[model samples]
Target: MKIRCLIIDDETLAHDVIESYIKEFPLIELVRKCNNAIEALEALQQEGNIQLLFLDIKMPGLSGINLLKSLPKAPDIIFTTAYPQHAVEGFELNAVDYLLKPFSFERFLLAVNKVRHKIELESRSAAAQGYFTVKADKRIHKLNFEDVTYMNSIGDYLKIFLKNGKVIITGETLKSIEESLPSNLFLRIHKSYIVAVSSILYIEGNQLVIAGASLPIGLKYKDQVIDRFA
Candidate 1:
């Protein structure tokens, strides 16, 4: 599979270096290059198929870290920066690898390999057991898709309600989690809620009942929700 990649960095030299290194990997496709966060954000919004991102932490405006925060669903990221001080924060944001500027081609290869391995493992796990993994409460949890009753969004975090009457709260955006879910089994019925299609009991006026809880359907999503059951 070709992994579509976008490079967001201010330095022309950084872009050149990365593009050169990417040529060695037949599976990595360089789709776009942006000099600043604003342009990168536009590209991200316009392109839905980007699988990986090469981002720089320090930029003239709208620092890379802030750009990452703004994205509702970010691609697998590998931070390419000159600053070592931001390493901790980069990893905290779930960066696949933090490559210090002037990194050798070998180092770049290692980071890209990690992304390949991660995608492969997730694909295998999802196909084999219908499970998805998330990090929450300082732990990584492997959860069965069928056990998820519904998910509620609370700012930058999500409260995932389960069939076993338990909730898992994680620092993940609703849009991000929705992208990872199986579209056939889950439906985003509102801006703040995503329900397991099978868990939905019935539809009331502008609302749906799932696991005995009533959740309102956003006006923008009402038509899609109705069509789901129609």
Candidate 2:
């Protein structure tokens, strides 16, 4: 399956270079080349979903990093930036790969391969079994998809709270877990949380009354969350 992509950057030359690189592979379809996140968000709203984003860390008003956090359904991101210091934060934001600025086309291909492998593994895993795997203590533990109520992100860790009050905390991004979970059952409510709709008691302001806790609903995700329950 092809990965649909979007390039969000303010530089015209950067957009051209990225577009040229994307054309080298037939598996990628360029949906938009947005000059800013506002334009990108407009495009996303108009066109529906995109699978990946080649985003620049430093941009005009809304930086690429902040853009990811503001999105309702955060897509796979590969941070293409000049600053090496941002690498740690980029990975923390769950970027699939980090491409340092002035990177070659060859290196760009490498990053895409990483994303491709992840997609294939997810597709195969979903097709083969109904269980989701969590890595803990050097081993992968598979949990049935239906047992999870909601997943929370605390700093660099993720906690999976099940229906029976059992939980497992692991160091995986909420994005990866969001991808691994059955899409029909899990909904993204904030930058740091994904909830099973059935587990929600109700919505209070931006918070989800979920399992005796109030989870803040992300600003970008608020409308969809309300629509889902309305």
Candidate 3:
């Protein structure tokens, strides 16, 4: 499938440069070019099903982040910016890449290749029957139906708290981790946590102590949580 892409840069030269660069590959199709994020927003509405966006962080009406925020469903964004300060913000939003203004085609290709690799993984994940792999700093952590203890959300990462006190930080969100973990072993007791029924030490009122950490038991999950241990 062709990856439909949109470029939202304030500079005509940058647009032309990207247009030239994309010509090397037949998989990427430039859908539209916008002067700023405002124009890009309107174009996204018209294009409907775009896969990638080459966004400039500093624009006239709406910044790249502001544009992404306004959209109900935003496509993957690769920030094309002159400033180096937005790198932290970009990763926080899970941006695919961050391209400096004077970047070369080689650099741009590297970023695009990363996006392509991500798309391939996402495609595989969609057809994935049940299992999913989580990555920590050094290990390719596997979450088999049996090995899972539970997961807890801490910012963007999830803490896979096991029964034996081994904890792993996965680069996935709470929602993704919940879907991949076995429902019987892992129960989401709060918006921020999912715990193993076997590992739960005890419950007091709305407080749940697991592995010596006090996690609040959300009112909605309280009954199911108690029933899990019962």
Candidate 4:
């Protein structure tokens, strides 16, 4: 998926220059451009999925630094400004890169590459830790692979059974969930059921015992399940 981006700057010329530079990157999609921090804040609250920000440090009302501070969780930022003094402060806020005013297209490209690299590293780290986020009950839930015992499908929703006896209902399909889960940790034994490979206690005939519950292994999946153990 393309990285969604937002440009927040008071100057029309700054917006034009950034937009022109961004067109060279097919992977970056500019979603919105804001004149100031307040407009950017409103856009952020409404969209909630912007991945990258081209932020100017100094603006008329609310400075970009203050805007970043106000956000509970800010997206990856690349500070663009005329003043070089704020570069130190921006780095303290974990900005990917800082570009001074009248920056060349080459410099903008370099900064964008840094943002892409940072995002890639973060994704790899999250995957390595076996952590995934899912939306449930109007909130995002961060779950670990070890905490999930199995998943059951009911119509259009999925019921995720946890080791602690708590079930989370999410409006997601079994296939989608299966694709997101680590194959080495989770195994699809049936069309409607996916069990954690480490949680399997035993297999008897065409059924597998997991978390003290017996779950069926589909006829077509039985061979693969046996092969997994073999």
List candidate 3 segments past 4 Å from native: 129-230
TM-score for candidate 1, residues paired by index: 0.58
- The TM-score leader among the candidates is 4
By summed lDDT, which 10 consecutive residues of candidate 1 come out lowest?
Answer: 120-129
Find the candidate with the highest lDDT and give its number.
1
**Per-residue lDDT over 1-230 for candidate 1, one digit per residue giving the tens place of the 0 to 100 score:** 55668999999999999999999887687878999999998877654346799999889999999999888768899999989999999999999999998999999999999999887776565556687788898999988888999999888788999999999999977766766775567777777898988899999999899766999998756766777687
TM-score of candidate 2 relative to the true fold: 0.56
> For model 2, how does the per-residue alpha-carbon lDDT over 17-37 read when each residue is reduced to its tens digit?
889999897667687899988
Candidate 2: stretches off by over 4 Å: 129-230
Q: RMSDs, each prediction?
A: 10.0, 11.0, 15.0, 11.6
What candidate 1 gets wrong by more than 4 Å, as runs, is 129-178, 181-230
Q: lDDT per prediction?
A: 0.85, 0.80, 0.76, 0.84
Tens digit of lDDT per residue, candidate 4, span 153-221?
A: 888898999999999999976765664665567777887899988899999998899767999998756
Ten-residue region with minimum lDDT total, candidate 3: 176-185
User: Between which residue pairs do clashes occur in model 4?
Assistant: none
**What does the lDDT read for residue 226 in candidate 1?**
75
Question: How high is the lDDT of residue 57 in model 3?
Answer: 88
How much lDDT does candidate 2 score? 0.80
Runs of candidate 4 exceeding 4 Å displacement: 133-230
lDDT of 3 by residue, 117-183 (tens): 8876765664354456888997887655444456777888878865566888878777555545444
Model 3 residue 152 lDDT?
75
